[model samples]
Target chain A: MAADVDVAAAAQAEAAAPLKTPLHARHVALGARMVPFAGYDMPVQYPTGILTEHNWTREKAGLFDVSHMGQAFLIGPDHETTARALEALIPADILNLAPGKQRYSQLLNEEGGILDDLMVSRSLDEDEDGALYLVVNAACKTQDYAHIEARLPANVKLVRAEHRGLIALQGPAAEQALAAIAPEAAAMGFMSQRTIRVAGIKANVSRSGYTGEDGYEISAAASRIGEIWDTLLLDESVKPIGLGARDSLRLEAGLCLYGHDIDTTTSPVEAGLTWSIQKRRREEGGFPGAARIQRELAEGPARIRVGLLPEGRAPAREGAEIATPEGETVGTVTSGGFGPTLNAPCAMGYVARAHAAPGTRLDLIVRGRNLPATVAPMPFVPNRYKR
Target chain B: MAETRYTKDHEYIRIEGDTGIVGITDYAQGQLGDVVFVELPSIGKSVTKGGEAAVVESVKAASEVYAPVSGEVVEVNSELEGAPGTVNEDPAGKGWFVKLKLKDPAELEGLMSEGEYQNYVKTL
Candidate 1:
């Protein structure tokens, strides 16, 4: 099936093939509405459409080709030393991480603002000598790699896994979809990690997802990933989903998209992600911008992340102005859309800490009209992660 | 025998006597990919030619349907409220938007014919 895919050496393959992922042909054949994203042409949805795809994943399983996301590793002599080195750069608790386990963490700048949120998994080994597997966002991969390489010490090494492709099988039926090839995957708990064979292809499968569903993320060699993807999709319950659905799913799940919800101008505390930072990181203060984070944690941040529910049906799109009761411009919408699952328009933005509480009334200046709004709790739909 | 006409925005209308049947063209529904929700005009509501008469919201974007000729709304496709997907499935058939009593049938003279609409969509 992959005869046309000529896999040269890893370095040459990326430059020669122009970075087409394993599902490229399948997407075209299935009549997927493809769009360019982060240098890769990926399907935003199939002929069935984005709305159907979004609802399908919410009710069944949605298979997504996330190969554009950067996957790499950090290798060192032992786990403790590696963890300590990693803690200096990110806000996650790598030192407390157990073998065969993973943690969601943010790579932060020196100012305690988020650079990118990423997944870090400790290799399943007792000797503590293993690589730290990482999956970074597709759009920020280039800058993230450079940032990591620039900060690493002499003992720690960063290596890019260029030949690998990543796929996310998310939603209610994810476990059943993978049980055919990896039975252990079905038994895996949330945030757990393990190496497994997918349709006989060597892969690292993690029980995690961004869509607020029970799911698994599989990373495998690029040449063999197409086989695994095709095999998983053979089940009638599984359908190919796209970025458009992916965004809606994440938004409904209350998960934040990097550039839209969090950026260098916003800190984790202000973004309502202070829970992800370890207690030790908050106290001992070894990582970058620890002092700022600790102070914000104590005194509270000035502006806070809050959900906005527009009174009318018209969507409050990004950059919409947020105002107080007397028409005082208080905040701006960072991300906004009509959440399919919620069946209503929802938005998220930063507002002054005093007005950040749920039920706080606000007005959105949308299209020259003052749209009445209220601060609602996020994830608009409750996340059903298999913990 | 009368002429069927289309607009750049994708609505198509067939004029018969003093009345006309309005709906989105096959090209419009095809470009929209799939329809999810549709907003129709109230019966007896008077609308002007080229004014927003209805709205068809596909999974991708919401688009306004403009009146082909100034007319009074006589009938609407109530079935669309429950099955807007009909627009994507059969835009020119079961997805007909509305039937209106034309104020000036002469406005029909300004519309593009079926052949012209087909050619127009090709350029897009």
Candidate 2:
């Protein structure tokens, strides 16, 4: 009798249900293993399992449902005003961005810490009227929109693309797969965007991704994403992928997850993303954390993010402490896991400048055991993005 | 004929004369998802009932495998070191973790039967 009540409670929690993406029904149809993430019920992996899904994406084209990501457009009457407004919030040189060009950047706090990392792109189509398209972290979009809205000048405005769903088709075979359906997308260079039609549905496609692969991220109306997903899947080369592989793929690519590898306390220079900041921005000192960032750019950050290759099969997961051979703590692993492509455990962490060199030996304390590790260059798997 | 017993933590012990074959129940492996590494207890390591005796690392998280009854580790399934996913593939069978020389057979009485464990898992 008591057991029945317990079972009922479990069912009740499931009934409460989190938010669902536009492709939620399709995910169920595919027999995907669903889990709650970023306040949405997302598929962690399909029946093929995370290992296979990750491997498939590395070798062939993998279609992912990224609708849960927050998409918005920063609008203004002219490009100059819009770009400068964005530049004031981030450390990137948005004012100089060519139309149709996209740049990865971080939103900064007053202390020069990272608020959230995002993709900022200038409107490719002239009809957009100097509007800049932005994609922020899924969990931070609401707050990011509010933050930008409250700070922007009256000439510039923020418009949430709340009804849009995003999809990412990534990997080595992406070009061939997408060219058959959307020929114009194949013409886009890396970091370039194009507003085109996919199966007659208007979409904004970008030849940029977080997986360190040559791929495309498509933004379309939420109501049309399901049709787009079905059209893409009809082709043999494209297979549905889930968040589980998404994480491993990004980890192997050496990208930092917003809440994991970076947070409010981490600075762009310390996170090994100083390259994203232009020389003009670094010298002029205009963004939110410009002073601290400029100083870090001139004088290297005290500690920087670096990759670690643990010697054994055991993965030293997040929060694992990094110590010197003598056992003095020097750093912490922010993101670590088994890399399917490398077929070995890979990790990234922030360590003291002296200990951040590639091939520097360190010990990782994982589950009470000191495991030998070496600081290695990132993107454990070679990035195959088409130039 | 020997009978099997299960702990509330989802560990199972199959009795065979003076020895008990230990492994996590199928329900536990399902909950763990993909098994990446399994840290087996050293042979001859003594363990007390309800104390941690082994470690199971899954892609999701690591869990401690506790002793259902006091005993000395007589042997471990070394094959699991190479293929930890076996715990998810054949959990109740070839994925057994260790074999313990029972310190007191009377302790088995505290464990649940297969029927009881199924009901317990349903409640969870």
**Tens-digit lDDT track for model 1 on A193-257?**
98888888788999998999889999999889999989999988899998778877887777888
**Interface CA RMSD, all predictions:** 14.3, 9.6
Go through the candidates in order and give each one's C-alpha lDDT. 0.82, 0.87
Q: List the residue pairs that clash in candidate 1.
A: A254-A379
Evaluated at residue B96, the lDDT of candidate 2 is 92
Worst 10 residues of 1 chain A by lDDT: A1-10
Model 2 alpha-carbon drift over 4 Å, by segment: A1-17, B122-124
Put down candidate 2 lDDT per residue, A311-359, tens digits, no spaces.
9788787889999998989999988877878978888999999999999
Give the residue spans of candidate 1 off by over 4 A. Answer: A1-19, A126-128, B13-23, B34-90, B93-111, B122-124
- List all candidate RMSDs to the true structure: 6.3, 4.1
First chain of candidate 2, TM-score: 0.95
